[model samples]
Target: MEYNIDLQIDKQSLIETKSFLIKIGNKESNWLGDVSIHHQATDKFRLLEAVLLDHRLNVVRKIKAKDVYTKNADSRSTFFDDHLEDKFSLRHNQFPYYIKYSYRIIKRDFLFLAYWIPQYYSNVSTISSSLSLTRPMDYEIHLDSIGEFTYSSTRAAGLITEKWSIKQPKKIGKADFSPPATESLQQISIVPSDINYGVKGSHASWEDFGEWVANLNSGLDLLPEEEIATLKKKFGHIEDQDTLIKKLYHHLQDNTRYINVSLDIGGMKPHPAEYVLINKYGDCKALTIYMKALLNAFGIPSFYTLVESGSNPKSIRENFPSQQFDHVILCVPTKSDTIWLENTVSYLPYNYLGSFTQNRKALLVNKGGSQLVKTPALTHTDVHQTNTYHLTFEGDRLTGTLYSKLKGEDYEKIAYVETNLSSQEKKKYCHKYFNNQGFELIDLTIHQNSRSLPEVELTAQIDLPKHLRQVGPLRIISLPASTMPASEVFKDRTRPVRLMMPIDAHDKVIIDSSQNWTWKLPENFSLISEFGTYQITYELVNNSPVINRRISLGSRDIPIENTAELYTFLLEIETYESSAPIIPTH
Candidate 1:
């Protein structure tokens, strides 16, 4: 079954109607017809029409007023979508059936609208989805699609425009990896072209938008003298601006939980700081507001930055400037570096921007207006995982003392192991630094500082069978080959491959042979590719062999044609690692 939704918008007011045709294949197939609308305190939805049809397209059941119902969505979460629906059942219906329904929605707030162009119309070989938009009065509109989609636009009337049809729609495949939405579909971002929130501010340009945002919250940005004095008295000794910024961020985190209450202007205007302080809870917008207030009290300046929050990085349409962001964050500028703070988290390290906001573009709203800026890019240097191992072998029983530290996104990973994982789970992770097929954890100890992104460390001692292979008089020692478990295998894949996470890792293994043993070190080996670099070093110092291997990926995106080369590069590195051996003489 497939469907199409037609929507009409006039600023904050909107009307949406959808029609779905379902075919009953067998007795086990579904035949119930349904139409639904989701609404909230400000915006609303109303079901307009619903009908069920038989084989001859004859109307079987017309939705009665009693068929509609509304209820609370879910009890498990505080924030959930609530909706009303008009439903009809055809349990005894024949094989062929048709269903159609329509509903209208009042968005009320036009800060942003996400319209996903329909792609699944499979009854026929191909079906095209279209969109038509008309601006209110003299306002302008903006629309665009990701790279995969091709579209053209035509004017209808008084600044009225219509995207007659969408082109180059690809069928959904069973491939495990998903390309970014921006690259997969055409997105129609329709706004009043003026770029203003229409609440008294001119958002025609970044500077205007920033000034308007600054003026919009001018009163909320202030802290009472008593409140400022109290906050200062509590933190009078913290001199560093960055440290103070972090301290205030911690204060905001400690003082509030996220309570979502969309009212008045809806998701556009943020709650006042005073209200949040008294209520002890606020959403992302409110938290950012309160954090800004705290910083203001301390003579520090920060801007309200809007961002699309997610693990996946999404960019603001550089060419089109409208409401594209779903969340708000606070950006603090300083002397040595600009500090980005996530006021929602109490435990993440200060100034440590993880995947949620890292490497994405954001709208920084300040007094001068708004400016588009990029978040910090997580590199091998910022997000690194290093493991150091000291090993000794005696009678096929290998003992290793391993210490490791995870930084950046790598650290962002284990950062939750301490508080979130059970002791057994933590031990399982600790073993990864030392475990081989034949190894056993003799003793393990772990240390961590998750309150900030300083680092997560693990120390372990393991016993394993001697990996040494004796080739006549020369003893061969092949260091354990490090690996990032294979996440994707696009064997015989025809489509473009989606680039996965960038890897930045280094492993150091120091072997202290029996005091009487000596090693003949091999010359260091290095290989640099367009993707990344791989290197191996074998150094024998005072009868102990020090081995270091580094894998630093240069980019996170790659074309499909390069998959074979990438696979070969990784395979060669694996083979080279296993083949390179230290020759130790006893």
Candidate 2:
């Protein structure tokens, strides 16, 4: 892969050309032979060349650029944007072949010059890769990368050319529980010091970026006079700030819906508050500003906050700040506490962030500019689960009732299931977690409790006829399988391992049989490590075998040096699971 960028300082534009030489090894790598070019409607794009070659380097076919299909990027009405995409696929019956293609994109007044990822996947090794950039000698730019690369620079006439390259890069297979690609892969990003995309902006600092965003969204948060008067009259009797904010937030949720709006400078600038009030629908940016306008009616203050929102969010580079945020929320600070409002979803409990936006740095866009601040973090108490089960055997069938309670992220997950799925679908979903090869759900119920950090309770009754097995003279009782990682998962691991999510969970199981059967007592033990802790206890109460187990995992990224310890800890869990086989003796 060869990536080149030419910075036209005088015109404040960037001309990027990318050429790829990919080999199609199998049916799966056939995706590499496909061509897809994405650009905004306002930008200029040209496909210079595309050809398919056989194993002998002879031209098998020539792909014409005119033959490609071009259409709107998004066909859904909920998503409105000015972007276009051109795409075509290359498929052949030959054993081994090569595909070569090159394209150019011209961007006028660009903020980000290039974000290059040479390696397509962890299984694909790169033979050779290079990135070359030519710009005015005096013009300033920002460049960042993940790992070391061979770099050099040369100056000719009035232009400077810098090159970064990698040779015969080895393939690094991804392991289970590995961190996100952006954190564990090789990448590079380049940005100009100053730029304009309808609204002027600079990449020199976070303040400059925020100032650019502030200008785009300025004077857009106005409400009608009659609406303001109505709001004032309605909230006139309420003196408490928290109650007023809650009322306004609930009003925003009830009156407005979320959509994707990507107009006016690529949707960086939000639509006006009046648009939402009149249309009753808006995107994240629009909804946030609408909520801000509602607060303004009663003289309350809030900031339009930008955040990188996801279950496992991309880490924000504080030192090299750029346009890293993808979602917006409203931040309101009172005397006693600070409130964060995610106005996109109507069903989310008030003042709840869940896992999407919690525990991350957010940029607060204000009139003066922007400032970085930390959002609330989650602890074990916030993301935890507890389940209790009582099992009874009747002839060859096993019947059990499960009582499950969940909080934080778990609550959010179940809440989605409760809202989106039907009763039969919910029962079908419960079968997967019951851990039996075959089972029937007798009853299933879910209850959602609304609070700042809400909780959900799931009650289920299940019948399993395949669990109890008779092996010669021994009768064995099978329980739910543990989710601990197996040894084969960490084999040939090269990258660091990290816990996928923060978890604290406990489970209790009780067995009762009409026949007076004696059981072999399993030893109780506990193992603790930096990654997390595990414990299990077994006892006999009222002639029934009672077992209690717990596992608490901390959210930590374990470096390569510490992975041995993680492997050891997981092996202990596997051994403990195998050692506790429930068997009945007469």
Candidate 3:
């Protein structure tokens, strides 16, 4: 894959300047020519022309506007300045076809425009790519990359253009389990080095970057005088700062809904406090800004911060600071605690960063500049999940009530099930979530607790599998077969391992035969490794077979050297679990 960027810079009227990009590739390297171009009203990028030129640089056909599909892209709302997206398709849609296409765009200056290497899920070993830049030498620019990128300049027609190219061997694999920066595949981030947008002074350091953000986001505290006094009146009774924060947070949640409003500079700088207060909705940026404004109303200070947020935690490179964030939140300081609020989730609880932003670095803005701070880490107790089952065996069938509760990072999964699963689909989800090869959910109820912490409760009556064996009186049962939480054995033990999310939880299983039969127990089964511990305990109380299983995983990513130990421990658990069939003696 070859990507070329030709920029005609207009320092005075940046939007008036033109930038053309060309991409050409084929499937021999697993490179399919697919592109999506985005343009907004404030910095409208016009597409002059686009066509597929064969390997010989001959035009096969031009992409017509009619043939192209354009749709409005609202990261949040309709008010976000008429955003447009164009998707182009070439003559065919398979590999082994070589085509080159180019499109011209008019871009706003001083933005972090970039090309991510080895597009998500692309096998670098099967592909080779390069990046070329054609710009005036007068523009001092800095290009950010994790791996080696070549730099060279050529002079032609009194124009000195610099080019940087990165080529990888076919079938090159990437390891991305780092703490501060997740370097999955080397990417390129390009920006003008010594430039300032409005106030973001320079790209030289994180401090300069923060100052620039501070300038663009200046005056975000400007709210209506009447509104400020009224806002103060609302939380004035609460003397304690944390208590006041809880009240104000709940107030914000009840009054506003998340509607994304990202367009042009709106994508970065937020809307004023009054706009969101009147509209009662905003994206992460606008909402964070507005929350800070409300805090200001009560003489509480807060900072608008940027972070790369998602269910799977990601980190920003501490060494190389660039604009790579996708979401924004507010950091409010209290007398003894720092509250991290995710503005987009209107129903978020107080100081609950959820799994998306917890234990990750964020760029907090101040009048002086930017400071890098790590969000509060979620502990084992914080991310807790518990599952319990009460079972009674009658003849050849096993039926019981299953009660489950998930909180913190683990709760995200069950919450998804609650929202996405229909009444009819609940059984299927039960089977999947419980890892039961076969199970029937008699009835299921899901509860989403959104006030204090992110919690989900699932209560159901389930008929479990492996209940009847050989259709005989002396039957065997293995309790908590799939209740243990662990990853299916990882095959790539040689690769570096990084825990994407921490794993820690407890589970219990209780089986009763209605006092009809006595039970047999296996030798104590327990496996302790560096990863954590898994234990299964059993005892008989008045002809009732009581079973308890608990597993707590310490880290998300295990080191490569210890991957074998982790694998062996998990293998033993699976083996012992599968062999724990006990005989019921009547």
lDDT agreement with native, every candidate: 0.65, 0.78, 0.68
Q: Which should have the higher TM-score, number 1 or number 2?
A: 2
lDDT of 1 at 205: 65
The candidate maximizing TM-score is 2
Better of 1 and 2 by lDDT: 2
lDDT computed for candidate 2: 0.78
Off by over 4 Å in 3: 6-35, 41-60, 74-82, 93-96, 116-128, 135-138, 155-159, 167-182, 198-200, 413-438, 447-450, 466-474, 481-489
TM-score of each candidate?
0.77, 0.91, 0.86
Candidate 1 lDDT, 179-276, residue by residue in tens: 55454544455544443453555536666666666776777766677888899999979998778887787888777877665444544677788878
Residue 52, candidate 3: Cα error in Å is 5.0
Worst 10 residues of 1 by lDDT: 75-84
Sort order, lDDT high to low? 2, 3, 1
Best of the two (1, 3) by TM-score: 3
